[model samples]
Target: MSSQFTVEKTQHPKTKPDQQNLGFGKHFTDHMFLMNYTAGEGWHDARIVPYAPLSLDPAAMVFHYGQAVFEGLKAYKTEGGRVLLFRPDQNLERLNISNERLSIPQIDEALVLEGIKELVRTDADWIPTAEGTSLYIRPFIIATDAALGVHPSPQYLLIVILSPVGAYYPEGLKPVKINVESEYVRAVRGGTGVAKTAGNYAASLRAQEEAEKQGYAQVLWLDGVEKKYIEEVGSMNVFFKINGEVVTPALNGSILSGVTRRSIIQILQDKEIPVVERRISIEELYEASVNGTLEEAFGTGTAAVISPIGELNWEDKQITINKGEIGQVSQELYDTLTGIQNGKVKDTFGWTFEV
Candidate 1:
């Protein structure tokens, strides 16, 4: 919400080795963007300060209540060296939705765009020109008011940080095995699951660790009440191919409405694929898999645009999908999505925002 910003320049004094193969969210850029928000003053004191530690009170509300929300996106450099952003407006809109749900004051769309542009332009050189690498941008707001109560904090801090990230899967897109957890739930009805808040991810750590120990890439979270309907997988939204239709879980107040998921649905519908957005039960998926109706399964998100789900391990049963490889439709979807993102194909939907 802060419109006034004092621009400053800083540098990363020490550099690491040529770690070209570094995975996502590992390295940081030179500077960061920060802005403060108070109850009566709204947002103010915006600055592009050095990327360093934050001085917070021991009794900060965020430390106790976890009143924080964040969004993730990327800045890509095109073939002609023209940097661009894919559907940044969509990300900004989603950030506001997250903020409102978390009791934080909504940010002005224009200011948010300007702040993002300023940060990306300041760190433009950090945008990796390599094939699967780009500048990963993380914008977040946290409750900073020194309060011990279990309520929303009146003061908050909004900041954006950049990171040079390699391809999510450096070895090319590979199918991942997922384990469905029937014990723990990622989201519940009327909860903060839809918001990109810190608590949701924190609650998923135990399940993720358990999945990893079981030789699964991520946990396929089911609905909280019944634990029968499919919600999402890890942090990504899940998709399924049943019969000849491409279907995903309907945005029913529990799962995150990912920008990548919306883009894929639009592309599918544009190409005349029978794309359906509805509640999909785990039993239906298992039945479809057994009857050869479920052809493929995958997850969609910003980090990995579309990741194939090779196998779904539930209970003691293992169901292999698309023969442990990327399916026909999944490959096409990935190609079209990434092509539009990298400026290789025509962006009919006007999703690419050239910088």
Candidate 2:
């Protein structure tokens, strides 16, 4: 594990973009944290250097076999000029989970957390102050072994980059349409679905692109095995409120254990809301929609926090959720989560980490 890290400031800093239109992951901060892992030695040579394109060997295993793992979190700037992070330890812990699944070496979570704090402090100016805006943190590891093969790589490189981003969607908190994807499967039960790996996302691009072309925001994925049970959305975890109960898909080793999803469940429990994590089938969901029991639906993730689902097109049958508007539960969850994030509300859950 690397404890001490070197900081190298950039001499030619790029101009910061307009906070109003920063968009999501479009602009990066001036500096990025990088570390290396060797076969004999553990993680070492941690440094924060100028943000630039990486120069890797063309035969790097990551280019060939896609042995990469990544995690996403955020840093918020409060109105009182203070910085806060939301459930960063959970994110770092999940980083190791992905690493274990991807055959990449596990990272020291505490060390990485400290590195993240230092990196955030180094680029403090890049933290956006606009409404519903914050600094996005991306930590990733790639197999850098020059010799490519099907086996694990001997060397790896870990990088942590910061981005000044607004809301993940143009509609912001507005509910968006979701397409129920029955054609392509995201991951099987015994596959790399739970891991935050690149291939999993690459497998989703086609479905997402088609959904977007059809005027939808994203695709709600089904379980790969049955293709009838709801798994998750393309980018976020899906939740449904039906018959006065909150329901989300139970983690079946094929769905990502989302930090936001966990937080939302905890929040619901704290408020004594009936929350259930189980296998929800599309047929059951559609039946509830027809029976007028489906009350609300939303997707949770680090980038979007809470994205209400206004409409769902499954097998060419569309249903408008909560009259195509964000429901009471969705609104409350968004407000509570964002308030804690931006220091607007009291954080009783101890989720916010002040920086």
Model 2: CA > 4 A from native: 1-3
The sequence of per-residue lDDT tens digits that candidate 2 reaches over residues 85-168 is 899999999999999998888899988898999999999989998889999999999999999569999899999999999867
Model 2 accuracy (lDDT, Cα): 0.93
lDDT of 1 by residue, 1-355 (tens): 2345677777444374254775788888778989899889898887887788999999998889999999998888888888788888988898899999999999887787778888788778788877877788899999998979888899999999988888888888899999999999998979998899999999999999999998999999999999999999999999999999999999998999999999999999999999999999888988888998989999999999899999999888888898899998998999998888887778899998876
List TM-score per model, in order: 0.97, 0.98
Task: Choose the strongest candidate by TM-score.
Answer: 2
Backbone clash tally for model 2? Answer: 0
